[model samples]
Target: MARGEELYITVPSMFRCPISLDVMKSPVSLSTGVTYDRSSIQQWLDSGHDTCPATNQPLLSKDYVPNLTLHRLINTWSHSSAASSSMHPLPPEITSGEIRQLVSGISRRPDAAGVDELEKIVRFASYCEENRRFIANLHDSIEVILRILIRDNERVEFLESAVRLLDLILLENGVRERIQRLIFKSDHEKCFDSFLSILKNGKLSSKVQSTRILELIASTNDSRQRTIGEKIEATLPVLVHLMRTETDKHLMEAILSCLISLSTSRSIKVQLVHLKLVPILSRILSDPETASPTAERAIKTLHLLSTVAEGRTAIAEDSGCAVAVLDKLMKVQRKAKEEGVALLWSMCCGHGDARVRERVGKENGVTKMLVVMQSEGDDRIVRRMCGDLVKVLRGIAMAESSSSYGQGGLGSLETKTTHIKPY
Candidate 1:
């Protein structure tokens, strides 16, 4: 044994149990629902106590359920911190044979027992990074997990665990592409269809993970995007609804990233336009408190959507759109600002009548364009856009001025137009 001087001098409060006043290596929950260090709780029960030590309530039983999630969190914290690492031993390694045996057992049972075995394997994998890497390398691993996932009659816990496991495996480099190719080669439309079903009907956690997996699959290439777009009739609306309703930032960001990818296709852009995604994007952009990266994606997606007629109409219809685009002129990141400007130009330059141009001018768009042009140290493209926008706005102003003259002072209007070049 080591000397007393080598023992831990202090433990983190969150890592300690109230009963033992020491770091908990194996935390467990008692019948009263109070958690304590397993050893201390067991010792108290072994003394024939009839009440919970923490709650002072009558015990339902002496049994305890392992807090696997909390245990994983503790293990992660212990591995990552220098102070904790000195006092704790890391989890043991899980070998390839063990993983294969677990998979085979799950495949054979397919009952509650199989689910317990699968959950055990998942817990073991979640305990350490090495276990995940080992599982990722196993041949036919994705196939086995997908097989279990596609079973309609399985328990929800089993499906959730299967999705979580699949996500973990896909996070490994090159694994996503392999799975993509595997699904493409096989008759696996049902595999992809299962994702839409989950997104529509699964619990919140499962829906979020399923969306992540769909985004990963959608990002592979144009062909895959088209494939998914054609198969799922309600995919676009579902994503837009989630973006509008989901409050989680990461989930919203994931949905936006997938939207950006899907909107890249002109064919699909029309479908997205029909879904009226521009108003949704405009809402996100106009809110000053929106996250910077999320706003960037919103405007970029708007830029793509603006390539079509319906998209331009939707944007112009939103009263805050011009201001939203103008708000990002110099306020957001460079890419976002560039996209915002492009979207604004698209709204004005292409088939935008005098009424549209006047609406832009009414929003102080001309002054904003001049500010962007005069600001130093910007990309040449942005400066060029500023100049073009100023010219267009001034031309519209001149045309509106001439038209308002109503042929009563055509000569006077011609003289004023000649002097209007500077703005």
Candidate 2:
């Protein structure tokens, strides 16, 4: 056992539970003569197993007797203060019976009782990582919690406690894999629906958890990504609403990440633009207080949005949005610069908006920024994009100048040549 910086003690292997692999607080002996933690052996027995877990031998009797000798030794050894000045205090021990009782209560009762059980589970799990692992390892724990989320979703208090508990236990790999499996199953439609409901109506923390859970599922693989993308019509609006109403930076970041992951299909992209995702993202980028990481994600999502015609058109039509994209050219992050260049290139060149090109060139001074970025030795691709943007802007300038001269608006039409080296 190790606690803090001042204490270290190697717990004897015999004092650990074979099933949980944690220190045994209550040791018991099965019929096969192997001593185990009372809670671990009791859980095994309650699960309807008749054989010894360690030896897999037929049990002469299913009942286990307490091994008082081992318990006493563990108690004495654990209380020794001579080994170190200070040891990390252990959290209050929770028995397997208590876990089973709570889980059973949650499954059988779907009222205030269920909510109370969930709160108890959350409190116990929150006490320490060991308790979390213990509860997560118990069969049907995560399933029961998910069922509560799906069944009692209309109950705000129940949903809040259940979602909070789910978030806490989601740190376990087994729990996450189980959630992924449930999400992929065809019959589990209500499971995903429950998350959407939470996003729309639950408290802010619950909404954040639901968004993060969806983000995790969406990021797993192509199949999961496609599954989530299919729900874009239902999911996108709620996310946009949250982004518009919520000021919490963390939640905003989560929503942005979820957006980036789910914006995979062309139809989805079109819907995102229609849902005003472009302007929401634009507003995020326009804020001076947005963190660097959040800014990068917002830019990346906008870049994705810019892939479609509607997205590009919206961006080009909003001059503040256009200026924001241009401003990214001066950011210190290489990725921001790269994505910013690509986004602008798409809006100006891909969209073929002469006004945007002129505005970016004449008003935003993108020409000077691009020139400096190139001169400072950016990567080859960024330099190439910079070159392309410069050429496009210069072409637009010449076209406008020639148009003015042909209309007889200017006093003199003088041609000047300036050379820029190719990237």
Candidate 3:
């Protein structure tokens, strides 16, 4: 008999994952192949934890020798049962004693864990990633976990790690939106007392609590389809509040990312600009004395302002969206540079109506384009766009010059101030 065989066995019975109380399958191996999960099991065996579950005897991860004998017995027993069941009439219900024994057997397995409690937990996490409906409402699980962590017990330190793991669980469809609404009261005013209390006193880390706030206010459920106007109307207040008071970049980043979703609709774009968010943003980006890392992020938010066609037209009408962008263009590279060039191109090329060109000319837009064109931003696209702007400027200049040099040669002062009406 093996010396340490007793230690290898489950104290009272068999074992299982709290999740998927069934025997674990496709045990994932980590990079070291030591830990197990679905994705990396084979790698785990390759890294080598060879030992039989029964006797602690040397066994490969793939085929621990003990299971072979167990498998043969199960196959023979199953074959005999099948033959008997096929040939005989069905039996009556089992006696109470037999039922109790069956129930007892299932309960005793370490894997059973009093029922599939751990299995279901693990399974739901699996469902989130698979987009399967494992749980009736998985976001509820996130909330439950948060509230548990908020009590500031042993799990407080693990709150962030739990969230990251939940993110890996990816609830698709409008699950994101559903959960957001679920967390809040139907009447926003009604729930403020409770939510604010948590905000003020919860022991969950700031990042975690802040994450919940952003999730409720700004994050989209995978299944939602809100126009920018809808999102602005729905979340603008919460976002505005956070923008005023929250400084954590990640929480701010989540809010900003949600705001980016609003940049798609012209109605939403005009409304936000009209609300005066632009000036606040501009101050953030160009505050030389108060420059911060987020200044670079504020620079990137230029994309949101420039993306809307109507918004660009509004900029031409003096929204300051363009000026804000041109300011950022001074410090562009990688993605920031890419967005600047694209926004500039949109401002110049995507606009309709000659009034935009007239406005551009009036705003010293020629000088701005000329400077960008002269600098390293001289990508062929920028140069061509600048060339176009200059043509507009030159055309305006030429028209003035021609009026000054009227048909009467040098022209009289009164006649030189001529008006040429369009036909």
Q: Which candidate achieves the best lDDT against the true structure?
A: 2
Tens-digit per-residue lDDT, 1-423, candidate 1: 445444453556767776646567678888787878665565445433556765657677889887777777777767764554465544545556877877766556544346766666676665445677787877766767777766666656667787877875666657787777765544555565566666666777677677667666666677665565565445777877777777665566667777765666676788887877878788887888876656777878888888887787777788777777787777655556777887777777656645557777656566677666565245677667766777788655455556666544445544534432322
Task: Write candidate 2's Cα lDDT for 1-423 as tens digits.
Answer: 355556556778888898757677568899899999765576456433566767767687988888889877877776677322333234445565887877877667644355556777877875545677888888878778777766733677667777777876776658878887776666454667778877877887788778877776766677565665556468888899889889887688778888877777788789989988888888888888876556777888888888988988888777778777676556425555578778877777666687678777654243554554555484777667676777777655555555655534222322111344437
lDDT by residue for model 3 (1-423), tens: 444332222211122212223222223322322323332222223322243222333343363222333334323432354422432112324433443343344335422222233223433343222323333244344444333233323232233333433443333356455445544433332223333333344333334344444444444443343522242354555554665666655455445554555455566666666665656665555445423224444545556776665556555665454555556665543345446656555666665445545544445454555566666443676567555655555454444445666534324422432331111
| Regions of model 3 farther than 4 Å from truth | 1-143, 146-233, 244-254, 262-267, 289-296, 313-321, 352-383, 386-423
**Please, what is the whole-model Cα lDDT of each candidate in the order they appear?**
0.67, 0.70, 0.43
Task: Supply candidate 3's per-residue lDDT for 203.
Answer: 35
TM-score for candidate 3: 0.41
The runs of at least 3 residues in candidate 1 whose Cα sits more than 4 Å from the true structure, single-residue gaps closed, are: 1-96, 104-113, 224-228, 353-356, 374-378, 395-423
Q: Report the C-alpha displacement of residue 404, candidate 2, in angstroms.
A: 16
Q: After superposition, how far is residue 32 of candidate 3 from its true place, in Å?
A: 25
TM-score of each: 0.68, 0.68, 0.41
Rank order (by lDDT, best first):
2, 1, 3
